[model samples]
Target chain A: MVIFGIDLVLLISALMISATPVLLAAIGEAVVEKSGVLNLGVEGMMITGAVIGFIFAVNTQTPIYGFICAAIAGALLSVMFAVLTQYIMSNQVATGLGLTMVGLGLSALIGKPYEGIKSPTLSKIEIPILSDIPVLGPMIFSHDAIVYFSVILVATVAFVISKTRIGLVLRAVGENQEAAHALGYKVVRIRFLAIMFGGATAGIGGAYISLARVPQWTEGMTAGAGWIALALVVFASWKPWRVLLGAYLFGGITVLQLNLQAIGVAIPVEILSMSPYLVTIVVLVGISLFGHHTAPGSLARPFHASQ
Target chain B: MKFKSVLSGVLLAFGFGTVAFAADVKVGFVYVGPVGDYGWTYEHNEGRLAVEEHFGDRVETIYQESVAYGADAERVINTMAMQGADLIFTTSFGYMDPTISAAKKFPNVKFEHATGFKLADNVSTYSGRFYEGRAIQGHIAGKMTKTNKIGYIGSYPIPEVVRGINSAYLHAKKVNPDVEFNIIWIYTWFDPAKEADAAKALIDQGADVILQHTDSTAPQAAAQQAGNVISFGQASDMADYKPFPRVSSIIDDWAPYYIARTQAVLDGTWESTATWDGIGPGMVSIGEITDAVPADVKAEALAMRDAIANGTYHPFTGPIKKQDGSDWLAAGETADDGTLLGMKFYVEGLTGKVPE
Candidate 1:
């Protein structure tokens, strides 16, 4: 049950919980990148989602409704990025960065009234029959609805991106927008939808933190997790499944390191503290490198149908 | 209206506006966390607000919040200096070196860095003796833990945090010799999610009492979710979660000190100084001990609080050994200010070395 002073079951459970937010954010970002749009405002949108979701949760006393509103809030903020980059034809990098700044400032203003307020929490759903198993059940089958939702999201995104007709058009648009346009595919429209999806998931991710993880509202509480999700997207090489891997790996190490420290295993706190980021990036980057996964060709490129 | 505007502009050009501006003292504040954190930075901001309220138009305060540590801190300090700030307060331990470096370049501009030991001719250090509070929390945690495991969420390995750890451990060990401390160095002062996770890990590991040295009520939230676990608030009165998870709190009262320091500046008597104040001076006050704590334990904790405030009992009194079991203080001898300020080792009973 315990190895190296760490309870494996508790450690994995914590990993699942911690990884959900980043998994949601990265998976959404992977889709946006696949459509050749790099909306760099994940931090902004996520925080906006965190505060909005927290506000809704506090008001409605229902975690589910808070999540829905949080997703909508994230997507709505992303629409700002979508407009400037897609319709007005502004630079995607600059526009995304601006969105992040806007999101941070806006969320701080909106969350002022909600500070120190406890949010309604999402209870864990232990799957029947499977949750009865000895070690595996408690570790994997027992988690909140959002945790399972995150895994299913990765699977669904993977299925849609690789095995569906929609996936092919998305790839075509990201690889070469002009070619996709010449072939009568709606490049801008497809990218817009992808940006919205990314925003929605990011919103859910932020909501998860406020509603479940910390279950309290504090300004800048998302605290750069959005930025970490942004990094995971690139490291995963625009793959939905790899995003899950990177998030779990990052979360797992983070929890493991803390547990190890708690149990009095001194492994150089500096190295241990940084191991989550270093190990996750190394392993994810290694997989992407060996797997020959490159980013979408038109990533961060503004598409103009007029040449 | 144009003629009236011209007449007013001409009157203002006659040095009336300039006369008022000459008396204005520009003060700057640099915060390590969002001012809305409702903890460390929030309390510091309360002090800044007090300065504004006390002086009104004679003093103008501008603050830059959420400034990152290290190189980012240097740039923020430089910007404040370039903006003609007469006095700047860098309110975080991580801003130590940056504050010192900035003070050197802007010698005329006074600097105050919190919870750091480094000083220059122009740069001063000031901090609350929060360890005095940790000692009380330690007593409650030690006596109340059914599991006998006390979980600590430490932000960094700085002397201030280290002092708190030692003071808490010594007090806890005194009350209950079987008590065990599970210390987690989170390396961050204000990350809510990590703070929550650390609290959960401690709880899952059978820790019934949690004490956080970090900002935010996430740990208290985590403790509340776990049902049986109890926690103490740090740097602020997190009274929202009272009577259960948040049994008590260490409220950082910085308003009085802020007023005193600002007055010193206005009186043309401002000098580089180091201030390490505690409950005696009201810089660190314990919040109401809730019903969760036993009546006897609560009374004892308050007695200790009074003893500490009146200088009869020092938290770091003698008969203590270092983490390595070496002599740190002899019987009846209190720890000197210099050793406490530069504390880098744990006390005798606390497990694990202080991470530098």
Candidate 2:
């Protein structure tokens, strides 16, 4: 019974750890899509952040600076997307895809030397009074600052989107960019900021993997987490809290399957290993059938003043 | 006037008499992962460094790490060829097709693909018998484990990884008849986060010993964090962690092979062929056995290594049974390359199926 209890706690902790990157990326993406821009280059941005963060952290032996550098790298890469799509009037989808490709190539080139070397891990923040609580202490309070930051970000984003005027304008741009443009709202600028914000968050997400989760950079380490975040934006119906719930839900599935295999569950390892993705797809299809009413009016479409 | 023209012509001929030598031999390396990964790529880079160190003036080495084994690989190879590389080494199994195609495109350049079988006249294949190292580690794990449950973190379901798991399990079972091997396929060669998660999961399930075919120190770190789990280094010597983790390691010594191959090219005797070296050729080396191991266990492991090296014993000798208890190898028979290369299932002692 004691072993089972420990296993359960470990599994939950694993879920939280796995969900941190996705949550950070998805929430930022939520804000981006909320502001009327769909950046398909989240994966690319995350990978770029991963390599840059790894290089910075490895060189300086400071994980905090690594994260900051990662955010900046992600933001810089996003600016390229912003310039092409917002300024030059290129197709947003094409620009975003191009950004991913460029980011992938650039990260590959830059990360060449830093591969395989472990980085300094982020220090954990043990919540003082709450950490002493029996089951939740180690699982929740004993996590690194990133986990708590993600939770706070989710709450802040949820509150901002539902209750604030700036979020109202962002939503207005997403709902009807032409109308927002007519109102002197500067739709392109708002969307650009949204995209940059998303990029920055995705950067943190990527760094979370490199600096905290894995604490090392490997080629293609993001491993479709960016895509999962993209899916999550839709799955959450563009709501912040839902995004958090969805990320953790998916994270739980991922952790559970591995734990199930570990506990010698009477199932094929391959099937268990694949179950998380399968479950995500199934839930996605189910949600699609049920109709996600909160989807952005101009989700994937590029918004142009002339259009 | 005729004398003046003769003098001018002789002066012009003297100016044109100076000649220049050919450029240095350019060698390019395409790695599947980063050079610092402390595993497969790290070992390969060590070999690259060795080549540079030996033929500093005669060779110019250039490498691009983390080249994926698909269209990107073809592009990188083409780029290297265009850059005037005389030899290219694509160091991954997935690079087999791309390497072959690139070799055909650049006939002047020699190509080497690690752990791949298909080769053209301009292309060669090379890999160390890593299973031998795994077998030795397995022997130690079997003898040392308080719980007879061994966990294997496999990178992929490919034959190379399968061979390692099977060989390790075979040796472990030989030592501890009650040993049960559990495998978790992480489906990637280099995701430390997933690798750590896998390690933790294994430890949680009462596996005191862990082995991995993936690259990175995450598994070792994970074992250390777990506070009692033991693990072996994947590709390079990781004994720095010592008694806590990195109880033993399978060091990939590609430097000698790389040096020899490059030297052959310089000497103009390079040829396309397949080379698979084992313990005998020093390709597979064991790291310093930790003091955590029982003295007797360490001695036994060394004895096994010597036997494997000296041809006195074969790890995969006959009288083995398939998982279904069918005869895999008859008595006095060793496993043939044909069987070993395509091995997918565990032997009779193993309980689980090789998931499709």
Candidate 3:
């Protein structure tokens, strides 16, 4: 069925695929920021994950194993950021930037051998009856496992952050690290774990591009996706559900702009290409003016055990 | 006595290293996209490999991939020159200014910029006439398109890309009068997700044939996933999707040019020149026309390829009109190199203005 000269089913399917990577990265970053640590090396960890995941998937001939290694690779790179920021008390922003550069270089080196090589693709899951439905069925019920996992991840994160006792401690550390430490909470340990979680998710996000989206390893394939994911965290205002909404919104605009051109809209193509970034800036400004900011209190601040 | 002997050996090794470095010609490449793109940059890197294979111990080649094209390109080119690279290939249109500027600074090093028009004493520009291949693709697309609607995913609105669009449209229109061209410029050289999304959008809008200037296999993948769509490869032969969506390709065969230029550098005969060769010079070769196309259409396409190669046919043969109804080329008149080199206006019948 075509609506406004666009196939509704195909548009939604493409939207989900395009948004999944950013959504995963943003949600992971949201969790990291909520734990009083701001790891700005999502791009670095993601590229690292992309290369490592691609290599493993190619060698093992298993897409799932590749994802596991990608997550591990991301976490391992974050450990470097964690050590510098948490243990050595380095500046989070500078160190995170360094990590990103390092990740880009490292991934390029590792991915050199795997260039132009295709990886094992993940097969889409189609529900026998549901997938046969008119419009909504193909769009919603039929997708690869990762798509469903992303939605489930959002819900799981929302529940944990709002209701669970562990979530309270994590939020407490972010709100007031010193106070949380005085109250006998293991602030450093909790923050370390949160950073690792962020790294793992970002890794999976990167891997998604290589293993599913493009299904091939290319040097710098993540492009600026890590940076986009980083921006998405702020756009979400530290909420998991909002991250999904923002990612899909960006994806929708990206897809819609192309559709507009396909339907022969006379607007210049440059303007259409710039629409997503322009909308992002406008939305960010709108959020600042109307939406209440929910940033962690100790967002970029270093925590010290002594005084 | 033993220590003195060891010191003499070390001095001998150091002397040999300097001699080897001075003797071997070092060639450097700066790529706008990654070598893994399997498209434009990948083909250039293959040329680089060809240089290494041809000269063996006489030459050394190194490349920096995924380099951004503006100030960063200037820095990378300068570094290559400073590091004693005798010849450097700045492979992208956006690297034109940087290549020229770097050429001014490093007079001794020869630089070649691809798909650009600027040239200096130390910097030569070279590009393939890809429009010739595009014309063949247009023929096949026009003949085989079930919807008579062809969707194009353009990278940027540069003259080179604009030229390809016009050539394809002209040929498509010749075969099928009802053929309509829908162009979507995503403004990126390589972004699989964006390319795929663009392909999907075009398919959704009743475009059964897809053509792309962007460097990725994603569009072919998208077309294959959608089923029954016809597409052609750009820059390189995407053989992985052969016989179906990717019916054929416009291959940029830079190996011969790269080798010839490198040989000239070795011979000290290299000079600044603007080379815009097409099939006649063998710079652009049409890839295999697969079985996906009908036999009659494939034969016609191959004949067109041979005619273009043998100089019997020019893709931009005249009697053309601009989009504004102005005369671009009169009857039996061909487009001059100068106008084609800096093409800005669209030919008659194509919709929309060229983006500034």
Clashing pairs in 2: A115-B37, A116-B37
- Report the C-alpha lDDT of model 3 over B69-158, residue by residue, as the tens digit: 789999999999998899999999999999999999999999999999888899899999999999999999999998999999998899
The model with the greater lDDT, 1 or 3, is 1
Reference-based TM-score of each model = 0.96, 0.84, 0.91
Error of 2 at A93 (Å): 5.5
lDDT of 2 by residue, B70-143 (tens): 89999999999999898899898889899999999999899999988897999999998898888899899999
Ranking by lDDT: 1, 3, 2
Q: Considering the two chains of model 3, state its CAPRI-style docking category.
A: medium
Tell me which of candidates 1 and 3 scores higher on DockQ. Answer: 1
Overall lDDT per candidate, in order of appearance: 0.91, 0.85, 0.89
Best by DockQ: 1
| List of clashing residue pairs for candidate 3 | none
Per-residue lDDT over A58-84 for candidate 1, one digit per residue giving the tens place of the 0 to 100 score: 999999999999999999999889989
Q: For model 3, what TM-score does chain A reach?
A: 0.96
Local distance difference test, candidate 2: 0.85
TM-score of chain A of 2: 0.94
* Clashing residue pairs for model 1: none
